[model samples]
Target: MKTIEIKCDGCGADITSTGNCFDYRLALVVETRAVQGPSVTAMAVSLPLDHDHHLCGINCLDQWRDRKRHEAKLWSDWNQQWKEEHATKDPSGRILAWQSPPREILDARRPEFEAAALAAFPMKVTK
Candidate 1:
C-alpha cells in the first residue's frame, strides 16, 4: 500500500500519516457548564481518510468518532480528578469554575484564520 502525504495548511509543510496515524487522531475536549451541570465534549479529531495537510481543517466529528467512548471516559475521569483537586469547604463540592472562552480568543485568532476564509471567498472581499 502506498503512503499518504499531507501538507500543512499554512506553511505547506509535509505531514506523514504512516504507522503512527493514531498519534494524529487526537480529540480536543472543551469543558463547559450546562443546565445539568458540567459537560465535556469533543472538539475535533483526525480523519481516517487521507487529507492534504495543506488543508488541515478541524472536524470534531471525524476525529472523535474513532474514539468517542475513550473521549467520554477521559472526560469522566478528568471530572473526577477536577473535583478532587478543587474540593471546597462549603460541601457542595462542585467545580463551578469552567467558563466559556471569551470572544477575544476568536477575535485575536480570527485574523490568523481569516486567511482561510478569505481564500474560500476570494473575489468577494478584496483588501
Candidate 2:
C-alpha cells in the first residue's frame, strides 16, 4: 500500500487524517481586448480554470475570510467615491453621463471583486 500526504497550502503543514483543513475553489471569466492602428477589436472572453485555496486550520481560514470582507468593503468605498467624482450631472442634479473606469483602475479593484465573489459563493471543503 502507498500513503499520500496533503500539505496545507496556507502554512505548508502536513495534513493528517484527523487534522482540520479547508479548500475553496472558484471560476472566473476574463475579458481582453486588442487594438490596431485605427480599429479596435471586439472583446475576447476566456473562462480560466478555477482558483483553489487550502488552509491548515480554523485560524487561517478565519483570517482569509476576514481579509476578503475587508477588501470588498474597501472596493465599495472607492467605487462610490469614483462615481461621485466622475459622474456628469445636469442642472437638476441627475446623472446625465457616465463612463466605464479605466483599465488600470479596474485592475486595481480586481482583488476586491474576487474576494466578494469568493465570500458570496464560497465552496468550502473541510476534512
Candidate 3:
C-alpha cells in the first residue's frame, strides 16, 4: 500500500508521525471549464487541509466553517467581479462560457450559496 503524510489542518499537528490516520475529512464541489464542450463540469475534490477547509477535530471543523461564513460577503463581491470579467455572454445575455475559481474560493462562499438556495425554494417545516 502507498502511504501519504498529513497533518492536522487546524493545529499543524503531525498526524502521520504516529500513524496514517486522521480525525476528519472534507471535500468541496468545484467546477471547471470542460475540455470538449462549452458546458462546465463540477466534481467533489479534496484540497490541502490547511487551505480553506480544515480537518482534525470538531473544534477545528467549526472554526473553519465559521471562517467561511464570515467571508461570504467578500466572496460574493469577488464572484460578481470575476464573473463580469471572465464570463462570455451570448447576444441574448446568457452566459455561454465561464471559467470557475479554485475550490477554496468557491468553498469560502458556501453561506451565500446556501442562502440563495433557501430563498429560491423555502423548505416547509412539518412536525
Candidate 4:
C-alpha cells in the first residue's frame, strides 16, 4: 500500500493513482476444465504502484478512495480475463513478466476526477 507521485508510462499523463499486480506462470502446472481443457495456470503476483496523493480542496480524500477502487476493479477484471485467454496447457513456461501501465516519472490526472481515485487504494510510502 504505497502511494507516490509518478508519471504514467502509457499516456505520459499525470495519474493520481495506479494499481499493479506481479503475475507469473507456474512451472509444469496444468489446469483442466470441462469448458477449457488443459489450460496453463498462472500464479499471483505482487506488483507495486506509485499513485498520486494530493489534497486540493474539500472532500478530496474521499474522492481519491473512489478512484483507487476503480483502478483495482479494472486490474482484477483484466487479470481474470487474461488467465482464461492466455493459459498455456500449464504454467510450465519460461514465465514472462510484464507491467501493464509500466512506469513513469510523474503521474497526470485531473484534479476533479483524480481525487476520488486516490481513495480507492491504501497508502504506504515506500520511498
Candidate 5:
C-alpha cells in the first residue's frame, strides 16, 4: 500500500494515519475590473480557482467552517439592510433605484477574507 502524509492546514500538525483529517475546497471567483460609460460592462477577469484545506481534527475544521458561516451571515444581513433602506420605487411602485455597499465597505472585508484563507495554510514569508 502507498503511504501518504496528511498535515493540518491550520496548525501544521501531522495527521497521517489518524483518519481524522478533513479536506475542504473553496471555489472562488475574483472580479478584476469594471467599465462604465458607453458599453458599461463588468467582466469575470479571473479563471476559476480552488483553495484546498486539510484539517487534522474536527476542532480545526469547525473553527474554519464557523468563521466562513459567520462571514456569509453578516454579508446577507448587510445586503438585506441595504436593500430595505435604499431601494427606491417609481410612482407605480416599481423598483427604480438601489445601490450595493460602498466600495470602501467591500474593500474593508478583503483583508478579513484573505486572513481566513491564509489561516488554512502554513505561513511563509518570501523575500
Candidate 6:
C-alpha cells in the first residue's frame, strides 16, 4: 500500500479522499499570450486524487471563486488605467493602442496580484 497526500488549492487543507466520497474536481484551461507574440493554451484536468486546483469542499470552492474574481478585477483596473494613460489619441479623441503596459510588466506584478487576492480572502482550515 502506498500513501499520498493532496492539498486543496483554495484553502491549503489536506484532502483525504481515501474514504470520502464528496470530493469535487474542476477542469481548467488557461490561455496565455505575449504582448506581441503568439498565444499558448494549456488544459488541465483533475485526476482521481491529484489536481492543481483542488478544493476541500464547497466553502473552499466559494473562497476560490472570490479570490479569482478579485484578482480579475485588479487586472481589469490595471488595464483600464494603462489604456487611459498611454493610449494615443487623435484630434477626434479616437484612441489607438498597441497592447499597452507590455507583458513583462504584467508578469512582474502577477505575484502581487495573487498576494492581494489571498490577503483579501485568506485561506482557512476546513477540517
Predicted model with the maximum lDDT: 6
TM-score of each: 0.23, 0.45, 0.33, 0.32, 0.41, 0.65
lDDT for 108 (candidate 3) = 70
Ranking by lDDT: 6, 2, 5, 3, 1, 4
Model 4 lDDT per residue over 1-127, tens place:
9876543322223345434954221112233434566675547833343433344222334444455567666556656555555554436653255334323311332333344444444343312
Q: Over the stretch 1-127, how does candidate 6's per-residue lDDT look in tens digits?
A: 9998767767887665545455554433343334565774446833433235667667777888898899989999988888878888888877876456778998898999999999998887655
lDDT of 5 by residue, 1-127 (tens): 9988665544556645434665443222344465556875436644443455666456666655565666566667767777778889788866788988789988897677556555543333211
| lDDT for each residue of candidate 2 in 1-127, tens digit (9 for 90 to 100) | 9987655433345554452656442212344445558865446844452354556667556655665666667778877778778999898877777786899989987976766656664534444
Q: Each model's C-alpha lDDT?
A: 0.42, 0.60, 0.56, 0.42, 0.59, 0.73
By the TM-score metric, which is better: model 2 or model 3? 2
Candidate 6 Cα deviation (angstroms), residue 75: 0.3
- C-alpha RMSD (angstroms) for model 1: 17.0
Candidate 1 clash pair list: 7-53, 7-54, 44-60, 45-63
Query: After best superposition, candidate 5 residue 58: deviation in angstroms?
Result: 3.8
Local distance difference test, candidate 2: 0.60
User: Per-residue lDDT for 1-127 in model 3, tens only?
Assistant: 9987665434444445444654444433344434887675457754434334325566555544554454565567777788878999999877788898889867776767665544543332211
Regions of model 5 farther than 4 Å from truth:
1-50, 90-96, 110-127
Q: Which ten residues in a row have the lowest lDDT in candidate 1?
A: 118-127
**Model 6's lDDT to the true fold?**
0.73
lDDT of 1 by residue, 7-44 (tens): 43333334345364554532233434354647755569
Error of 1 at 24 (Å): 22
Q: What alpha-carbon RMSD in Å does predicted model 6 have with respect to the real structure? A: 8.6
